[model samples]
Target: MSTQNYLVISALGKDRPGIVDALSKSILEFGCNITDSRMTVLGGEFAILLMVEGNWNTLTKMEESIAGLEQQLSLTIIAKRTEQRDRSNPFLPYVVEVVSLDHPGIVHQLASFFSKRSINIEDMATTSYAAPHTGTMMFSVHMTVGIPADIHIASLRDEFMEFCDAINLDAIIEPAQR
Candidate 1:
């Protein structure tokens, strides 16, 4: 029977134009398929996370070749075998948006609230900027969270709104469009 191996690979290095090209070259040469990937520039560094799949021997070849690529590109590369995960879940999706005066404990507070409820954050992005006209520092957070299907959305929304009001944040929690 034919078998496939899954790998989760991560790389970080100084931002440069050819980092992706160099990694893609090695991945191609090793005959592995990049199933999913996320690459971003954070500060002065380019970071990459990739999910790859291939036959056992092809993956072995990649493991051997990555060392050379790491040295040539001056990157920190890590690869680990991972089991294919079931992405389907029984949770309902919600989009949460928050805007408030910049403060240190905003993220921590939100995370604690969600953690207490057993909610799962699927993706989150946050940023800070000066508010228009006023020039006041503002923090904005946008996140997709999975709420357990058993929870009543109306009650949960009421509680969430109360929490936001207590914290002086302008927030909205709404159903996410698929």
Candidate 2:
């Protein structure tokens, strides 16, 4: 029987080309399969988070070589052993969209609202830009959320709308098409 090892890898460094190429080469050479990953530019830094799967021996080898990779790439790297996660989730998926004048605390407020209801925010991306004609600073948020099975969808949607209205944000909450 073959045993599998899961690893959570994160790296951050000054933004530059070849970051991904270097990391991918190391992972491939180490015989780890990239399962899921998110890479983005945050300010002047390039950040990467990935889930990799390999046999126990391969994973150990990767772990041992991570320090050298970090030094070579001038990155801050962190890796941790992770167990297989349960794929079954009872929560229903929903997409949330919000747009309004740019300001602080928007994400915090949304997180507070969801935490109060025991809802899980799975993935979210937010950006700020100037409105084409108005030249006003505008913020947009798109998020995937998981509503608990015990929650009432209609009531939750209504409450969310009310909260957004109070905050002067145009918002929409709808079932996500998977």
Best by TM-score: 2
**Relative to the true structure, how large is the alpha-carbon lDDT of every model?**
0.91, 0.94
Counted clashes in each candidate structure: 0, 0
lDDT of 1: 0.91
Candidate 1 per-residue lDDT over residues 1-178, each given as its tens digit:
4398888899999998999998887887789999999898888999999999999899988887778878998999999988686566699989999999999999889988888999988778889999999999999999999999989999999999999999999999999999
lDDT of candidate 2?
0.94
Specify the highest-lDDT model's number. Answer: 2
CA shift of 160, model 1, Å: 1.4
Q: Give the lowest summed-lDDT range of ten residues in model 1.
A: 81-90
Q: What tens-digit string does per-residue lDDT give for candidate 2 at 22-77?
A: 99989999999999899999899999999999999999999998889999999999
* Per-prediction TM-score to the true structure, in the order listed: 0.87, 0.94
Q: How far is candidate 2 from the true structure (C-alpha RMSD, Å)?
A: 1.5
Candidate 2 residue runs with Cα over 4 Å from true position = none
